[model samples]
Target: MSDEIGLILCPEARYNRSPIVLVENKLGVESWCVKFLLPYVHNKLLLYRQRKQWLDREALVDITCTLLLLNSDFTTAWNVRKELLQCGALNPERDLYLGKLALTKFPKSPETWIHRRWVLQQVLRECSPPSLDRKEQADSDLRDSAEKTRLSERLHRVLHDEMKVCADAAGRYPSNYNAWSHRIWVLQNMAQGNLKVLHDELSSMREWVSMHVSDHSGFHYRQFLLKALVRELSQSLHHHHAPWPSPGTSSPCSPSPDPQPAHHQANREATAAAPCPSPATPEDQSSVPAMPQLFHQEMELCTDLIQSFPGHETLWCHRRHVFYLWHHWRRDHNHHDGQGCGSESPQLNHTDAGLSSHPHTASPRGVGLDRVESRNGQAQEGQNAMEVDGVGIPDPCDTKRLKRGPPDPCPPALPSEHGFVASVLDGCLSPEQGCFALAYRKWLDSVIGQ
Candidate 1:
């Protein structure tokens, strides 16, 4: 045992060998690790099976921690730690710390992420009280409200710390799917319904996405936040309108009321056009900016990104989602306003003639190749002419007066958002760009055709 401890502590002695091999060869630690692990695991399984007292909590924790550090996918070890947590032998914070340490070694481990999620739920369950009983007295209601408020604050802190952990993991390993998925779960399940909090998160995410352009997870999270904001605005609008009956309302069976005068309609329109003050509280009856405007802003952000990363499939796919949602929203809004299918139609000129109007020309390499081909053709023609004239194929080096072909035509630029998308699709249609871009183009065409 002393030799095993020394081998673990001495970096020079541990060089080059795997940790398990070092233990097995230098100090014969495998049998010791298994000896300490198997009995504890068996005891826990027995207790779980027999529904008896969970004994030797400290020993179980020490053994399980060691085993898990060596092999994080050891489900039995994680189960033992969870039992320890339930039995009050281990605290939530300590479990979370252990999880973080394990994640540093195994960032992609599904078990580690699952265990962390379990710990978070345990923390939440302890902090928040049960929903108030309808039959309870007023005092119970007050207590429940206070407890909920406190719980919300604590949950906010816990989730904020977890977000930082996930962000760090993602930065270290950009393709860490487990870290990204865990962050999304936290946001969807744990975040409070506070617009200010959501807005701050949105600001942070904007910076993150800008820095990591190819991360689809970051972009997807942004979409989730935007959708959440839209839902909040909609709920607010519904609540605001629910209290007031329609202008001519009475009992449901009453005769219909007269239509409002044109002057009265004009006055209401004027009121709507004026700027309204921001609401003093979330529940106050104040109007949010129109939903289409929000979608338009997001669309503009996507356009900027697409321009910067012209060849990235993820960005293009995200843009497709944005457009799909935007079109649906517009359709709903127009229907609500009693307008028959919107006036602005979705159309793309899918012909080579349209390419002539695109502002950006073919890539420089393509243009260079065209120039080389034209020069070669002219040189070949001159040689053929010399042979026909019976000049005995004048010295090949003397054919230096080469005539150049007319320059490649410059295509005109398409300036609208649709035009930009169409141009990008055209550029990516080539085989070298891969199938993803082409498939997306086909999907876009179907959407426009609808």
Candidate 2:
């Protein structure tokens, strides 16, 4: 089947061989024939791989598509396509379309996502401009610049399309691990340290997770974004002082994230900004939320989600990640400052399945979110009013002017993690039993010593 119409017809998650009505854009294959269809395609591809007289390259592509759309995890069939791709017999875009269609029914298929990543890397390579000599550049600077722009636009289009494909697969299957993982890989490979891309993703995902509260993978992707945002913020500062890489060459891509330069160093106790020789102007800071404000907004979101949708373990788990990241960021800052963790800090614990989380805490230090500083008015009106557009706005409820005793003690110190967990536990239906809440409470106690 041509990639332009490679959409799979299967509706079931399991083998992805269900029958669907044939359409202009979809592939329709009967499930009952899937049993006979696979063995036939398998033998035909085997003959082609063996270089049989009749089975040729076109026959190979035709049979592999039939095998993969039904069994998306067929590693050998994908490898055959990869061989074809390497031999210049197939286009990267065509293979990407094939992978997207394979993912339609088998959202969690490991090999399908893997092949997609490989194809994406090939696309990235194609997008990179060839190195040129100084004389060549001087001769055609405008042409070179235009060529670079074309490559950049092509890469951006592919990046956005891949993100959408991953989102759709994730939506089709809750906790679709392969989908989210591939999305992360694409960002790290294609748009590393692009703050605008990260911000856009976080904004769109906010609404997606709101609708799919039980999808743990969606929340996990959000956590990845939060980490990436902080890392990018810190990296921006480092890059400001560091010399740029040569314009003629592109940086080599890493398959996974590299060891970052202690990103949390700049974001202290989840409130303070990085101590810099020259502070960034307020206008420069306004575009990004203060680190504390980010955490506060996230905490508020967790509270609202838990209160609105009671007893979802995923919601409670999401809350755990928010606290865990906040706690660790503060500790990293403390370590950077030569002041060790205080008595209230969370002990190091196993995070994310069985992996050891490098440095993360699940508790706050000193004041809670109530007293945190703001860059975007995140419920900080009770604190000293911030200067706006060169004018320091005085507090409307200043005791000396309004005759009120005090501005109400900073909104009762936001709520301690313990208190927040207790409130969530209190709201759960008895039949629902709030097991997720109880588990989260136990997590707080064990990790944060709350």
Best prediction by lDDT: 2
Q: Please give the distance, in angstroms, between residue 142's alpha carbon in candidate 1 and its true position after superposition.
A: 6.7
Candidate 2, residues 81-128, lDDT tens digits: the string is 999999998888888888888787788899999999888767766665
Model 1, residue 189: distance off in Å is 1.9
Candidate 2 lands at a TM-score of 0.69
Clashing pairs in 2: 327-361, 328-360, 328-361
Q: Which pairs of residues collide in candidate 1?
A: 357-412, 358-412, 358-413, 359-412, 359-413
Candidate 1: tens digits of C-alpha lDDT, residues 331-425? 34333333232232222233423323443543322112344567789977877777755665675465444333443332111223336555666
Q: Which ten residues in a row have the lowest lDDT in candidate 1?
A: 245-254
lDDT of each: 0.57, 0.64
